[model samples]
Target: MRLRVALLTVLLCAATVNAQTWTEDGDAAALLPGQTTVGSGPLTAINGTLTSGTDADLYAIYIDDPQNFSARTCGGTSIDSCLYLFDENGFGVSMSEDGCGAQSWLTSQFVAAPGLYYLTMTAWDFDPLNAGGLEIWNDAPWGVERAPDGPGAPGPLAGWGGSAGGSGGYVIALTGATYAEYGPPPPTGACCFEDGQCQVRTATGCNSLGGNYLGDDTTCTPNPCPPPLAGACCFSTGGCLELTQPMCNANGGAYQGANVPCWPSPCVEQPPGGGWSDNFDSYPQGTVLYNVGGWTGWDDNPDAAGVVDGSNYRSAPHSIAVKGAGDAIHPFTGIQGGKWVIKAWQYIPSNLSATTYFIVNSYYQHGGPYFWTVELHFNPALGVVFDSLRDPNATSALPIVYDEWVEIRVEVDFDAGWLGTVWQYYGGQLLYTGNWIQGAVGQLAIGNIDLFAPHPETVFYDDLSLQPWEPPTPPGAARPLFAGVLYGGLPTRTTDLSGFPNTNWLSGFPFEVDGAAARPDGAVFISNGGFSGKLYLAPVEGPAIWLCNLQYPAEGLAYGRGRLFGFCNFASPLGIYEINPSNGSMTLAMSTGDRRFFALDYNPVDGLLYGYTEYGSPTGLYAINIDTMQMTFIAPPIPTANSAARAMACGYNKVYLVPVYGNEGYDMYVYDLAQGVGGVWVPMTHPFPESQSTGGAAFAPGHVPGDTNCDGAVTFDDIDPFVLALGGQAAFNAELPDCYWRNADCNLDGSVTFDDIDPFVALLGQ
Candidate 1:
């Protein structure tokens, strides 16, 4: 038994032996660049075991051009390795040690005009009895050597030629170009323009983009020195014409910045906008179908057949073409849960069948158990099939022109509909929308899927990308402020709604409210931020009660005509909900696409809800139907630098904008609420100190009784208009408007806003 145990130990030890074990006296043979290579550099480490403190090994290589070079004992080994580089003449030209510190790597890339070079690897492993090996690269690709979260005490160093502090399997790459054209972006202020269609950009860089002669180090600050805003945006089909942001945003082409014409830039992600873009233009004329795994085929194999067609294309010098039915998939990151728009330009030379499919969010991997796959197929009879969710006999024809290049798109929203949804678009118009029936989970895979396998048709594709379809980041100073109507309490220090001479009518203490609204019964309702999911109701006569769970803590809440309305501005698409007054339950009223409403209030006069939408170029006010929830773009008249107002309260005829104090970094803008004047947010005086933070607002107008003006008699004369003007939102002209408030200042107060609502009702009762 003991002899068997000894033999077993010997077998285990012998198993670890192989090409991995480097011998000191082994052949000083040459090694190929990538044969033993790891991710970054050529492999030089022959899994060697250390003999003693004096043990070492050497390897040789011949180089024709001067290039960046480095060597290290990598692979998270505890080899306090020392490395040396010698010229052909045997002179030790350079040397490195645990220069990477705890990373225990020795690296140097300044090797030049190489003829013959020898690298010696040695380490100071305390456990010398254990097998030791030298793992290294000759020309290491630039990468973060050490990160705050990793071994070598460090920071981020990207690209090539940077040293790393972490121990890991590293490979080497060689570059002889004295100048680096693409590195980190040229300083933030420096303007950069790429893609035949670019946003307006100023011309200033180290050198012109398409030049090989280095030495162009000019800086272009597109802002301060604005780029030529006017320019022809070029499309992949090689179409070009001048257009601006608004035009570029809509036109199916690339919007290259100012001064840059379509002659050289690449066109990509036409019409649709995304954080990242590709036009296949970067591929040399003979490139092929490949994954990000560097030119691998659509099937993810480097040798997979495909072509970068320069002869027939859109946008630039190249587009991808598959001889037969082939697929290509792209991935995305940093996008939130909402709609992801997948777009691509495809040229199908021959006719095809409804069997020709395009897929979105398809994750049927390893061959079976299908996840959700939104497929678009061309069936001459059925038109475009919305894949899995197609209704029986429902033929929705997607018009596709053959032998021509056409753009196709699909919008996948994982956050809405009964089981998520897919909306297909053709020629900038929504073609069809289909809901997912099965597949509850999967990944975002956008590309081709052949439902009718082995179709002899070839499909050329280009400008494919997934863009985020969500709200613009809220305006710089826009914040949800709290405001509510008070029918039965004393104004407290915290719930002060006084814009000027404060009032005694107050809300039962505010609870750090971020949003507030009032029911028709005069009970004030409030919610803390959008994700809190909790709301409160302050009765007219008693304490505030923890109302039912809102489920969606909407940033904007309103009460009108016996119902509760709310706008939830969280991660997913902005959703509108109707809250039940009794139990605080919620029903998804609708989705406003990406339009984010900052605050809203129901207009008692028209029974319409008016509020601010901060999703477009400039923030604007919008009117929403109380019943249908259909929103009409009233006007984007507010010119605040970046959508500024966070909360607004409706008065008689005007809306009051409130600031969250410290949140805004710029001057507050005030808009004219009077009718006829288009909305323009002009800079206004900030009434509160910068430190004060207010969440929302409710207009409380008081009144003076018996005077003709607030004289108790409501009339259409200038006196009545002037008196009611104090009520706000009141449209007072020669013609009597419903908004004109009667300064029934029943309590003999000066103003006539909501504060007089109860008092006016009392007078009416008399």
Candidate 2:
């Protein structure tokens, strides 16, 4: 066993940045099995020569300590080669034949049971036949440190050991510790994890090597590559995102679990609902409904006509004070057709300087000079005034209670009953039901007809809405608000009223018909994305025609009284897009700061665009002013992880919402648009989760006038609710809400007032 050992410099062939300074050549036959020890040292480089595939160089080494053993072949000489390790008995231990782009390596565990190991090098194919050497190391974990040369960073120690007469930076010996605990330097292209990357490596190195190296002296332990850990995270805006848990929570999103997919969690489509709503709580008392709707003179009071006074309000925060002079006469947006129920919460001062009246200009009827008003006279002399719209010539003489909040309602028909019959309700009690008006209805104005300068009273009004009046309790979860259908089938703008009628007509596309918006022409456009994400011009009561493909899945879609708007996260810039329903085309409208919003709708009440999306810290309900693209946070974010999730609908003067629990259906929340963008979102009276899908909303068709029975007709059987109403029983008032007491006030007089006795008797005779 001749100990062939030497310490010297490596013969530089083409090692671009050569570091090996020593080497030794010993052919397999030259150092036959029994003749060993060609190289001996903890750190050494053996230079070997090969003439053919069978030619191999063998090195024998003795380990003093058990540590990880690593041997790598470095070169660019085009000699395909492999490194094999064997035990003292010549039994193979492990072998690695890796790719060599100037570097090839193999790492293995060293066991003490076989104290002696043999290292052999062979070529896969011989070409240039340049001599190569073996570099060995103790595999110290000292943080798995890499020698800045990373793959080509000058081999860790000199090619040979001190015993071979090597100088400083030479190898030393250590005892028994098999390598697994302290692995050698990793080859290039190896990965580092999120917190396990090197912290130091010159900017020049990182830039040149295509790795993140902040400075010098960086190693794999501290400046390692980031681990690829990604999944779904829910944001504060009810937006489910594909991000790491940390990124999700940091941006206000709740992590549902690990490995969650982004699409099924939702990344597109708009939910239904969005019109107008106001609780009069989100704005200053004088903040007129102008921003909410096209109205004027809300704060104008030069003549002291009116004021949005917070004091003496029936509804907290705000109510317009009518100091005579058509106070707060708001011209509501949109000319609603079909059946409309216009209702308002009002408060009249116990007494008045003269007489004030809340009127709906339903167009004059019965040959009257002005459109009729459901007049409720507070005058003790005039008595309990009711049903004035039915018989304007009548009067009452009975003392009636005043000075409290009261709701007054009226139904107007623009289709069959245009300027025809009108139904009035006082506190939900049907007061007048007949063809009462004669002209086309426009807007509403409430004030005193007798503008007496010495008047000593003011009228307070709040929560006014002209919504389609369907029965309070709809048959299903969602009652149809418009005549449009969901998108299905091919691209045709015609109605295909067939198949399953449960609102799932667009099952193939929307699968849910999730997002919806109404055109000014009363045409309904639905998408299968929220319900699908495809925008379409749908037929009323039938299937919808695909209009255009949304660039990205839209999380929210809304059609303003003037324009259509949609929220899309993948639409290039990730923002809102204005869709052309005529043809399926989209135009970029606004960016959402990369935030994912789930729903969008236009509220006719505040004339503002509102929607819900990822707040990145909380699920946020937001109102965006189109003119300034300014976003106003409406309320605190709703949590949506491991819960129902959140969905919203907008219309009338309210925003209907379903939070969390949406997966299994949850209670619906209604936010007043009058509350501006900060009012509390309260649950609606009913918990109908049926509307939790695409077309869910709060607008429904109103009862027809003259249908006192509200049975959709005026047959002889229509007298039941009226008869029950006269006696003040729950049966007759079933069609009304609490707070109403004028169901049978047929003669336009106060309840229990003597003036109604004669009229009642005459009506019974008929």
> Top lDDT: which candidate number?
1
Worst 10 residues of 1 by lDDT: 32-41
Q: Write the per-residue lDDT of candidate 2 for residues 435-459, one digit (tens) a residue.
A: 6432222112211122112245666
- Using alpha carbons, what is the TM-score of model 1? 0.28
Task: Write the residue-wise lDDT of candidate 1 on 1-766 in tens digits.
Answer: 2343344345434443222222222222222111111111122344433344444444444333344445555443565554544555433445554456632333344465545555444443311110121222222222323212222112111111222222322222222211111122232223333322222221221122321212234333222233336554543222234445445544433467664432222332322334445678877787554544223333344444456778778887788766444454442212323466767787755466435555543432212223335656655444443344453344555565677778887777755632457777766666667664333233222223322223566567777766667742211111112243222111111122234223212112223455667542233566654465677654221123455677667677776655677778772556778877546677777777767776776665556777777685445787778568687766664444444455566644455565544235543334445553365554443323232354545432222232223222343433445445444533432233322233444454434455755555554455
Shift in Å, residue 375, candidate 1? 71
Q: What is candidate 2's local distance difference test score? A: 0.44
lDDT for each candidate structure: 0.45, 0.44
Q: Estimate each model's TM-score.
A: 0.28, 0.27
Off by over 4 Å in 2: 1-511, 529-533, 638-647, 663-665, 685-766
Q: Candidate 1 at residue 494, lDDT?
A: 19
| Candidate 2: residue 595 Cα off by (Å) | 2.7
Error of 1 at 710 (Å): 13
